[model samples]
Target: MDYSKLLSKTVVDLKPSGIRKFFDMLSGLDDVVALTVGQPDFATPWHVRETGIISLERGYTYYTSNAGTVPLRRELSAYMKRRFGLSYDPMTEITVTVGGSEAIDLAIRAIIEPGDEVIIPEPSFVCYEPITRLCGGVPVPVATLPENDFKLTAAQLSAAITPRTKLLVLPYPNNPTGAIMTAEELLPLCDVLKNTGVAVLSDEIYSELTYGVRHTSIAALPGMAERCIVVNGFSKAYAMTGWRLGFVCAPPEITKQMLKIHQYAIMCAPTTSQLAAVEALKNGDGDIEMMRAEYDRRRKYIVEELDRIGLPCFEPKGAFYVFPYVGAFGMSSETFCERLLNEGRVAIVPGTAFGKGGEGYARISYAYSVKHITEAIERIEKFLKTL
Candidate 1:
């Protein structure tokens, strides 16, 4: 029982995910509507699923190349260039991992040394901070304000940088907040980064889900591409989360180191999933549009309804989540979500799960059907009345 001495302090010291704290309590509860998970409500496109089935039928079940299947990587390279104005050499610059989560880990591990600083924008995804810490990198969380639509401004980026800074995580079309950064917005940040050696890890997993405009990648900026690692996956856009497919596109120099860790840790991403992803990259543009249209409808409806209900939610132009300020109810985000689940039977994540900047806010995902979203809104309205 003296395992404490043998265990890595880093692992022990790492906190559990804040998003799961309340979700774990919903076990065995009936009639509870959970908007906690960020997975797409739609099924994986039939063509993409069919490819995986066909691959299995054809006995294409062996491990892929550590960098992933060449055809898949080629398709991913082309997809990235065409969709996001970012280019990469498929053979040498891209590595398919288990999911976007692995891509995050791989990129951080490759670039960071002990005591190296990585700037993270909060009220964003949950993994960047913990993953950076796991790699012995110090995480400098920059608060993304509601007024700026939760984007990491050039001023914030400039403030967080020092000589020891090694990386900045650019999480846009952001999770929890759903804020997007247009190219105009990114140009100033690019100016700040031009002469600096600070590398950027741009997580564009939700790139395809933008409502009013296309997702912008900092890598597309001139000179910025040399300093950016782009992480994307089939999970959010292609609705293939369970298949667990993702990739990282960076300079060959960085990819070389990342592939080393990935080689020893994970020989390759799943064979079936890689095959399926190829189909998604090649022919799934239409599927993305169809799903984005539905999400846009739901996004608009939920934002309007929440504001109408006096929650004063900021309109989100990207991703499927709507974050409404809940401090007016005189409760912390945790207390608000706890009470809503107990009384209204609706499960939304407390914004604090994302980071400190997320306090007094709650993340409500609109990935559900309109009917389901409407019902949740009604329940939320009733809960607010009781306040």
Candidate 2:
């Protein structure tokens, strides 16, 4: 009769996502200018959607190969090289996953042993540490600071590692903080990583949305191609979140192991999404450019407005979220977000939902319309006046 005793302790102890609770609260409110989740407001590019439509109309709905359609994988390989200078063999080094979340799970489950440590930078995507724990690995969080623009320094990484560190999660163009690692910024960390027998799980889903600087994949660094798994998807850049598609790229040995877990657990990725992904890679660059321009405009406007409202915000260089420090008002991040939603009727995620490093901050997604974001900012200003 005791459910707690019957369930796996790991699953029982895992906390549900903090982002969703705010989303659920906002869903019931009327006239709310909400920006809690990172769901991109842009429509999925027509060409990509049309391909999915055509596939469905033609009844091309059979399951894809365990690794995914060869055509799609080939296009992904080409896209990686074109966008980020990363190289991989489509047939042997990439496996299409249900989404980037699954790729993280597959990568962690494939490599980590029971006591292995997974070094994750705090203020990171929420899934990494949880998935690591579920896979029986220890989650070691290294706090990335606002003073350093939230980028994990070489000293932090050096200190986090031990003989048992099996992996390092590199989530740049990061979700909550929107911090990015440039090639220059990554050099010394790469130096530190070079000596350790650790694999890098690079999450670059926002790679296509960077403003001025192109994203540099750790996989492309010298000797890194052999020791990295790059996890990415159509969710953010292409506004294809509903498609439920993503992929991972690694060396053949790692790919082979991850592919096995993916095969047994997932069988294959969705067929329609696979076909559409091929179209996306081939013809979606223009769409990415258009969306990126709009996001850049909104990103700038939001940062300026937050400062004018007396909330200091970090000018995020990538992704569509801005992290603003909310501690000066003498409230915790959770209380700030809760009060903001109930009083201001504008929903934004608390940064501590990400990790402890996010204690004094709140994450505001700018993926909504400019008018919508502007309105949210106006309401937020009035809320602060009340505080």
Candidate 3:
């Protein structure tokens, strides 16, 4: 039997994630200073951890409600209202998920049918396109420009649509580019979406990490709430990545459908994580603030250092990553990343890992200690001089 022929075409056609290959090559290589992977270096806050511990000490381990613990859902609803001015009916609009990852997967599976097209802005999160394909949808990647600060314009949206477009993945405070869509930026896209049948899968996991201005959601735009699925989680905000917890809020119709897929695929989110996340929702405001402040400080520092070293990166508005152009060095993004790892012993992901629009760039995450950040930049600067 030919193993290659045995695989499904969808699995065979899928390209492996470019980011993971570089990371795999760098693993256990003792000298590399990595700015790869988008996760906060901070530990989960003590109180949040304590809540999980206390639950375990009392032997509270068991399967939770299919939606999640009622207490957590209630606190999550209140947390959204308090933090983002979005009101969700905990009983009808929310479904707890494994992570923002699972929330994204569930959202696509909930609505897309074969031949449906999912509009994805390039230089955005990688998962959107692959997951869309896995759900039997065709991914239509619209290129977002660095000149536009990587925000997708209304014209782009208008041009990308067709009768089969079932959804758009709105990844703001976005991953590799670190670009965010302001209220002004989003409103016109909302207008473009106004009468269309397409739904928006808004990933707002980075919403709480913005500096200076608040993050805006497409769901918050007038007339969008009913047509949007908002995915957020405690991973970035509360440093709970390993805990694997997240939630999605949408109109009851969509949520009801999403719940069916989630219920079958995940059963429920983690019980211990749900209990601790309740504490996070109730009292983690200070922890969010502290982490945001630290990221901002590093954000400013890295931008300055990169400029000082002649990299000239755009100052990222939100999230913990910086994307700097590497075109001047006359190397492909993959070659640059590979050579950087092999020569300078520094790890970063190629921008093309995101999409074609990211060809001449590389993504460096600031989710590490300042000392590590400083050291990484210093080495990067030295590496550039040799180039």
Candidate 4:
């Protein structure tokens, strides 16, 4: 069987996810304290879960319209407006997706064409670059520095833009690094993008998990929404990762085309999940607050612990992960993580898994309970002493 010849060359060439590699390694080990994945440790809010249960009990297991139910869309519309001051027509401008990941893929595919270029800021979530490549679009990675607090600057954005540039992925509050772009920080980049004919995919799945300051969507900025697709979901905020539901909000013209892809590829998001999401949007504010407060506590503890142990972590203001520098140990990010896993029994992802920009750092997720995080920190500290 000549499987190599038969398989899609692009899929064959694409590297397996770096984050998942460490996660998979854990399955063979016992008694290891792992902080590799970024899923919330909290359960889905009881009310939201109850809603899904009720929908199932009522025999609501049927397919929905390709764009999802009208009621769910309306709730999504209201939720966006209430939370971020963004407006989208429920009927024509919003399409529910399998998850924020799917929303990202749809937006990129809907816009990117062969030979186009996507400007991706690295040390980010691992999806953007590979997804762009799968679309036959070239990925241009711009390394966001720790000195800049990992935020992408206007100068960097300007330098990356070319006539071939077709889209820019704005991932914040970011994964792996936990960096965020405040309105003041985003304004300069927005100004640079105003006439560039480049669309923006603003992945804000962590919107409700920020600390000290609220999240500001790039689409909320003046003149930006017209060219931006806002991707968000119930995963982080509502602890609904298993629900497998997310949504995209964009201009009608853009969504009209994205829907065609969704109709053919997905048909619709899960019916039970969509109905449950309606309840989440309408009544899950308190759930978000409770979980976020706990995450904030964990965030502070992890950052302080890393610094105390001489790892020099960047204090993350958003998201649930911290990217701590591991270069002082004179080991590659992968080697550092491998040693931590094998010797310390504490698992974390290497920064190089994200991109070249992540070469000297490693990501530690604070999405676990204080006790779980404390155990991992102790193991890490013990491992550092061996250095």
Candidate 5:
């Protein structure tokens, strides 16, 4: 009868996701060309799916070890070393979780105490700030500028840190803006972080989706590995969103603590997914390249089309979304997207859904087909004419 009084105030007060808000608006609409979701349009590779099916056929429906199967962790260890040049003791440092979302939650919960301030670069993936609040940590959002390609700056990080600083969430090959931090760009932020007692949660879920440049993990940088918790998963890279699997690699001391949370909360990632992920790490390199090449093609087409339509877009070198400035039309980001959806039947997310720093822009995911994107952009062009 009084559910509001019974609910956790934090959960009650948390705003629903801005992305979902717009997506829900499309439920009853017909003939809408939507570019709102961040997931790849590609299905999971056939081999990867067959691996899971094979495991099920063998009746391997039992639970796994709290950290996941040893074979999976070992393969994950080798994959990390091979792809990113980062080394972690598979037995001690890596714990498989339900997804990258859970790994991020475990990392934040493990490190944050009440009043501990976590510095987040805004216009990022939507989870970090609200998750920090749930952990009783204060979220300090530093706006990354469009002029700087939305990359978090060393100066910004240095200024944001205080004696109470506990963590910095580094989400790159970032969501919403598609901004990425190169090794050289990350070096300055790393410099500022040295000896600060602040840990880094590097969310590299889109690591394999960059165009024209290889993904660099901040964990691979000198002295950074010990202080970083690297969270990655198969969802974006392998089109394995439904698998609900991911892993976190951190120093043993830190992971030991995070494992306690995972053990109590999740038990383990899905057994079928773990076995399939091993196959993905071992033989799915070709699948990654094939899908990434297609994403790169769509990325280019959407960016060019948006610019051609007079909505100046920042060329995204990483991730599969393009954020174009929509301020010239003199509407708030939400209003711009809402009007487009209602009047033009083109669906895109408003940047303000990500954070206040995203006020003047809107995010359009290029994760759909070239044909789907073409239709959406053509509709956008017509919408702009009316504006």
Candidate 6:
């Protein structure tokens, strides 16, 4: 059985994420301290958990509507309004997804045509490029730089677009780099987009995790609401990653089409998780505040520690990862990450895994407790001296 010949050429050609290799190597290595994965180190809030428990106890275990439970959608609509001043009609403009991961996949698959180009800003999320390729669209990576604070400049966007370009993957409050696009920074790109037919898929899963400033959505920009599909979830904001729930809000026509795909591919997001998300949407502001505060403290400490150790990193304004320049260490990112894990017994992801622009750096997640982060830094300092 030559199973290799049965796979799609697109799937076969795609390179696996380098981050996974480190995870496989680190598995069961008792001596290593891992700071690789980006997940909140907090439990799901008690009230949200209680809602799920109550739902199951009350025999509410049946599958929800294909789009999701109506009440959950309504609560999400209100939540979006209160937080971002964006209004999405629950009945027509929204579809519940398995996770932000699936929401991204659905949006790309729903709109992108064969050979169409999807612009992805690098040092952003890992999923955007590969998923775009998988959907028979060209993955056009726009490399971001540390000199630009990892933000995608309008000039970069202008250079990346072509007549075949059909979509732009907007991943702000970015992973790996922790870079966020400010309102002012986004205006020039928005101006360029105004005259183009290219659609925007704004991933705002990290919207509630920004430090110091309120996160801004492209959907809220004038004229963009209708052209954008906003992907958000309970994962980062509410520490509900395990709940496996997310939603997509887009134009009614697009939502209708995406719902068809969602209905066939995923009958519905988990019922208990949807019930828990309702509680999160309605009453989780305090939980968000407390978690954000804790994350900010860790964010500051990691940046300061990295600077003190001569790693020269950009102070991240949003998200919980610190991307530190490792060019001074005189090694490729893959070699650096492997040696760091094997020798220093501390796990961090090589930045190159994010994209080409991510070379010469590494991503350290602040999603752990302050105590673990402190120990990681101390170990890092010891490791640096040995180099």
Q: In candidate 6, list every pair of residues with a backbone clash.
A: none
Residue range 1-387, candidate 2, lDDT tens digits: 898889999998999888877788888888888887687898899989999999999999898899999999999999988888888899999899998888888989999888899999989888988888887899999989999999999999999999999999999989999899999999899999998899999998888889899999988889888889899998888899999899999999999999999999999989999999999999898999999999999999989999999998878999989999999988899998889988999888999889869999999998888888888988999999998
**Each candidate: how many clashes?**
0, 0, 0, 0, 0, 0
Candidate 6, residues 1-387, lDDT tens digits: the string is: 787888888889998877887799999687788999888899999999999999999999999999999999999999989999999999999999999999998999998878999999998888988888888889899889888998888899989999999999999999989999888888898998999999999999999999988999988988899789999998999998898999999999899999999999999999999999988988899999999999999999889889998888999988889999887878998888888888888999999989869899999999998889888888888998999
Superposed by TM-score, candidate 1 places the C-alpha of residue 275 at a distance from the truth, in angstroms, of 0.8
**Which regions of candidate 2 are displaced past 4 Å?**
none
lDDT of 4 by residue, 260-320 (tens): 9999999999999999999999888988999999999998998999999999987899999
Model 2 TM-score on a 0 to 1 scale: 0.98
| Alpha carbon lDDT of each predicted model | 0.91, 0.90, 0.91, 0.93, 0.93, 0.91
Which RMSD values do the candidates have, in order? Answer: 0.9, 1.0, 1.0, 0.8, 0.8, 0.9
lDDT of 2 at 220: 87
Question: Compared with the true structure, what per-residue lDDT tens digits does model 1 show for residues 42-64?
Answer: 99999999999999999999998
Task: Give all TM-scores, in the order shown.
Answer: 0.98, 0.98, 0.98, 0.99, 0.99, 0.98
lDDT of candidate model 1 versus the reference: 0.91
List ranges where model 3 is wrong by over 4 Å: none
Candidate 5: which stretches are off by over 4 Å? Answer: none
Candidate 6: where is the Cα deviation over 4 Å?
none
Q: Which segments of candidate 1 are over 4 A away from where they belong?
A: none
Q: Give the TM-score (vs. native) of candidate 6.
A: 0.98
As for candidate 1, its clashing pairs are: none
